[model samples]
Target: MADTRERDIIHAFVELSNELVDGYDIVDLLSGWTTNCAQLLDVAAAGLLLADGRDVLHVVAASSERTHDLEVFQLQRHQGPCLDCFNTGVAVNVPNLEVEAHRWPDFVRIARSKGFASVHAVPMRLQGTTLGAFGLFGDTPGSLNEDDLALAQALIHVASVAIINERAASDRDVINAQLQHALTGRIVLEQAKGVLANEGNLEMQDAFAVLRRYARDHQRKLTVLADQVVNREVSGQEILRHARFTSIRP
Candidate 1:
């Protein structure tokens, strides 16, 4: 079991490295990163929050709808592990949410109501600059072991680097532009997901998977493809065709 997990971790890193190539879609990359982190770390779910040019946090990606809503709730209330981690540039490990009620009352209440018992948030920082945070949610109360914690931080660090290196620019203006672009792309991607879901009579997650599969198969940037779908430049029927064929493949 341990060896298999080790292989999975290695494979995750390799896939991340491959996606770091020139002109990769930042939103798609981060979405996949959150999903990979949840699976690799054995967490129930994971979410990623990124700061825009104004340093305001936005929910960029999540492994589950419940996780996404929890991340947004933190931003709305301005208190939570991910928010605190982003502000302080330090990890916030809550092995048990019940124990942190006083620290983040609203966040803890909503998270527990959503079936999450613990959360660990790590900063996506490089050097002295903090970008955002990656949050892991568990269904039961317990801390990630030392090695797992280190691995989580490592993954967050790599993701931060990927964001910075996406355009090979280190200037504050360039970085902020990249971040803003990604956030905007996420909005369009969500609209595209709605379109696919309605057109194909599929769930939101499955619609997103179809969008991703179509994007990857056609060697198209996810954000760009989403934009086309939103603009009607790419017909929903064309995308549904791919989705239906893929689903029925033996």
Candidate 2:
């Protein structure tokens, strides 16, 4: 079992390293990172939260629907382990959510309601600046073993370096603008997905497929297309028209 987990961790490293290539999508890359973390770390769920230039943290990716909601709630209420990790630029290891009631009353309450018993949050840091945080949620109340904690920290360090290198390749203002744009676009995209799903009686994944397919076929940025949907510049039905037979990766 240990050997298998070791192999999985190595594979995850390779996959994350590959995301450093040109033309990689930051959102998709971070999303994949969370998925990989959940699978390899024996966690019930995982998530990534990035801080914008304004120092406000926003959810970037989530490994599962529940974790997604958890991260969203963190951003909404301005409290959670991930928030603490980012703000302090250090890891926050909570062996049990119940024990954190005094530290994060609302967050712990909601997390417990979601069936999460523990959490570990690692800061994504580069050159003294914390770009974000990686959160791991567990169903049982226990801390990550030292080896596992070290591995998680290493992975996050690599991710931070990759993100910083990518941003450094662009102009300062351009990177800031891009980060702000992605932040706003993600919120709009989430709303648009809900609108499309409800309107078309489709699953959220299917609604996202419709939106992604339309954007790819039309040579438009996914967020730009999402903005259009939110602004009523395009109809959800138009996206649904092409959802069938259109398979999107990431």
* lDDT (C-alpha, whole model) for all candidates: 0.90, 0.79
Among the numbered candidates, top lDDT falls to 1
Q: How far is candidate 1 from the true structure (C-alpha RMSD, Å)?
A: 2.0
For candidate 1, lDDT tens digit of each residue in 140-205?
Answer: 999999999989988988888888874445578878887898899999999999999899888788
Q: Each model's TM-score?
A: 0.94, 0.79
Highest TM-score among the candidates is held by which one?
1
Off by over 4 Å in 1: 166-170, 248-250
| Collision count of model 1 | 0
lDDT of 2 by residue, 71-94 (tens): 989889889899988888888999
Model 1 has an lDDT value of 0.90
RMSD of 2: 3.7
